[model samples]
Each structure stands twice: as C-alpha cells, then as structure tokens.
Target: MRYGLTFLALSAALAALAVLAGGAALVLLWPAMSFGLVGAAYLARRPALLGKRPDGTQAAWALVLLGPYFLLTWATWRAERALGRADCANEVVPGLWVGRRPLGDELPAGVRLVVDMTAEFPAAAAVRRHPGYLCVPTLDGTGPEVERLRELIERLRGVDGVYLHCASGRGRSATLAIALLLERGLAADVDEVEAQLRQRRPGIQLNAAQRELLRRARARPGA
Candidate 1:
C-alpha cells in the first residue's frame, strides 16, 4: 500500500510536470506517468486503502484509474498469451489444473469448478456455464484471505475438475493447486509437489506467504 500510494502521488506530480514543461517533457513523462498510474492501481488494490473505507466499496474509488489499469493488465495478459503455446488449462493432478483466466470457451470439458484468485480483472465468460464459480479476490503477491482459507481448501475437493487461475497461472493459481494436493492427500511434501508442478507448468511458483498457506493447510485433520 505504501509503495502504491507513493507511485500514485509520484505519477500525479509527473503529470503536473508534463503539463507545465510541455514539448519534450510532455512526450517522455506522459507515457511514464501513465505506466505509474497503472502500477499504482495494481499495487494499492485494497478497498480500505482509501480512508480505511468499507471492504466492498472499491468500485467508486477505483473508477478514476480504471482506464490505465485495464489497459496495462489486458496488454500484459495478451503479450503472455501471444508468446505461449497453449491457451487451455494445464492439469497438475487428474482433477485439478492451473492456467490464466479462461477466455471464451477455454475451460476444459469436465471442469466443474472455476476458482479465480485474482483481484486485478474479471474474466467470467469462460466459466459462465459452470455454476461453481468462486472469486477469491486476492492481491497479486499475497495469498488467499486467511479468514476463508479453510473454506477455500474445502471447496477445492470432491469436484470432478477445479480450474484455478490468476494473472499468469504462475503464482496464485499454482498455490491453490498446492493446497488441493495437500488438503486431499494427493501429495504430502510441498517441495515434491512444487517440483512436479514446475515440470508440468514450467513457470509455476509459490511465494513465502503462499507457502505459509500450504503449510497451515497441511495441518488439517488426517492430512
């Protein structure tokens, strides 16, 4: 939050500079300021970040920067998609998979559940027909909401297919896949599972906080 706000203020200052200096300054700093706003929107995503507001009223506050935020994220998503070889989910376990936000009809045939772990953007069209769509709006680098971690771990089970995703299918979605593995006893060792995930999805990774989530999740009954 601190860094995001700093960038927001910095971007505003840069915009002011661009307007005042004009010409060369305007040309270079305008694009720089635009990028900074996008960074600000991504970093300070919490609903309460503004005046410690209520948990669910971020829309009105976020309207100001939605333009740049969507443009940058969508562009990044497209760049990643364009460079990738496949658009569909990559199965880690038989019933579980990880991938970027599904577009159009990219969800696998048996995917009965779609768990989205990103707060950046919405991509529900791919999962529109699936009834068990879950939105665990999470910050980019953070783990799932700890208060609901247990519930999320449970929800990942008993389904024929659970399709999990984030911005790049590398972190958040991969972390959920790790939770499913441990929660369901499909895998016990986090190291081994991570290694396996990397083999299937070469870019998959989990952060410190997300690794902590997997640690706590493994302490479940009979787990």
Candidate 2:
C-alpha cells in the first residue's frame, strides 16, 4: 500500500520480529509476502519488464501482481472516487493532465506520453508499442528524482498533451504537474496553481516532501 509512514512502520515492526526470533523472519513470511506484494503494487520494481523489459526476478511474483495486483488497483480506484477522494484521472490544463496510474494500454485520446512515477508497473502495451512511455520510479508519498524530471519537462516543452501519474494522483502527480506549470511559466505562484488544480480535481494533494520539492523548483531553477 502507501509507503511513507506505513511502509516504514511495518518494516520496523518486522525487523523487531526478526531480532526477537533470532533471525527467524521466515516465521512471518506469509504475512510478509502479502505486505510486500501490496508494497510492490505501490512501489517496487520489475525493471526488466520496463526494459524494451534488470527486473527478471524469476518467480510467480510477476504473475501474481500483474494479474491480481491490477484487479486490486481497480477496486481501490473505484473506492477512491466513491469516497470523494481522488478520481481515476483529470485534465488540469488543456494539454496537460494528471491522475492515478493507468491500468490499461489505451490512454486518454491524445496523451502521447506516459510519465509513470511509481517503480513497479510497466507502461501499458500500447505505450510500449508506440515508444511513448517514461517511468521515473519514485516511491509513494515521496518526491521524484530531480534531473530526470528536468529533462522530461524540457522534452515536454511544446507537446500537445502529457499525462503525469503516480499511485493515486493525489500527491506525486500533482506535485509534478505544478512543477511543469512553473517551469513553462504557465503559472507563477505555486499556491495559486495548486488551488486551480484542487478545483479541477477535488482530491488533489501534495505531501510535505512533495511540496518542498516544488518549492525547490522555484527557489532554484532547473533544480
């Protein structure tokens, strides 16, 4: 599931279990596996799968996740909308969009680029087919890497449409979208743009780290 505090807490507790059990962590393997699969869905990697496919970890792991993991994502997104949280996706600007991860191949009509911020999922088949995909593998509840984001922003300088996505479209995706706006000089004030974004998509939110990164983008250009 979501990383930040939850991932860290669970990991800490699991470490305690191992220590008290004299390293018999396997005693908790079943529950550990469950938690790990959920974490993978949110932030882990099958990097080779993103390769043209390092992530060649041979096991039923990929099978389980790509199959059931996706179903779980579907249910989660549905529930997110039902609870007045984040929806599947939203177009914030005419040519720029932000939202949760796309579970399928076909993107919104003209979205030629898929900027996946999470670590695990591969670009959809269609995205790979057309070679219009980029994965910048950031963990949930964190900010993305700096240099890659700059390069991608430059690449998107005049593109007709782009879709920026993270796990829930709430934090990471919105943060990046705000940076893009600031970089392109479309919006000068961070708070104002964020307000506009929230109006368009009520569930849009940026975590503290995400907001700090955005602030850095303004305080230091091309950073």
- Estimate TM-scores for all models: 0.75, 0.69
In model 1, where is the ten-residue run with the lowest total lDDT? 47-56
Cα lDDT tens digits for candidate 1, 1-223: 5546655776777778888989888864654555475555547555222211122223554444454555666798888889887545788878788998887578887887788776666655545445767777766666665546778877666777888888788888888787777667766688888998888888887777778877776675455
Q: Show pairs that collide, candidate 1.
A: none
* CA shift of 207, model 1, Å: 2.1
- What residue runs in model 1 are displaced by over 4 Å at the alpha carbon? 1-16, 19-64, 217-223
Model 2: per-residue Cα lDDT over 1-223, one tens digit each? 3562364456456656766776556455444444454554445422233221312122355545344434555576557656754556789999788987665643687888777775444555555454567767665566655655667667877887788887678787888888888887877677888998998888777777778767765665654
Worst 10-residue lDDT window for candidate 2 reads 49-58
Candidate No. with top lDDT: 1
lDDT of 2 at 37: 49
Alpha carbon deviation, residue 87, candidate 2 (Å):
4.2
lDDT of each: 0.69, 0.64
Q: How accurate is candidate 1 locally (lDDT)?
A: 0.69
Q: Could you tell me which residue pairs clash in candidate 2?
A: 48-53, 48-55
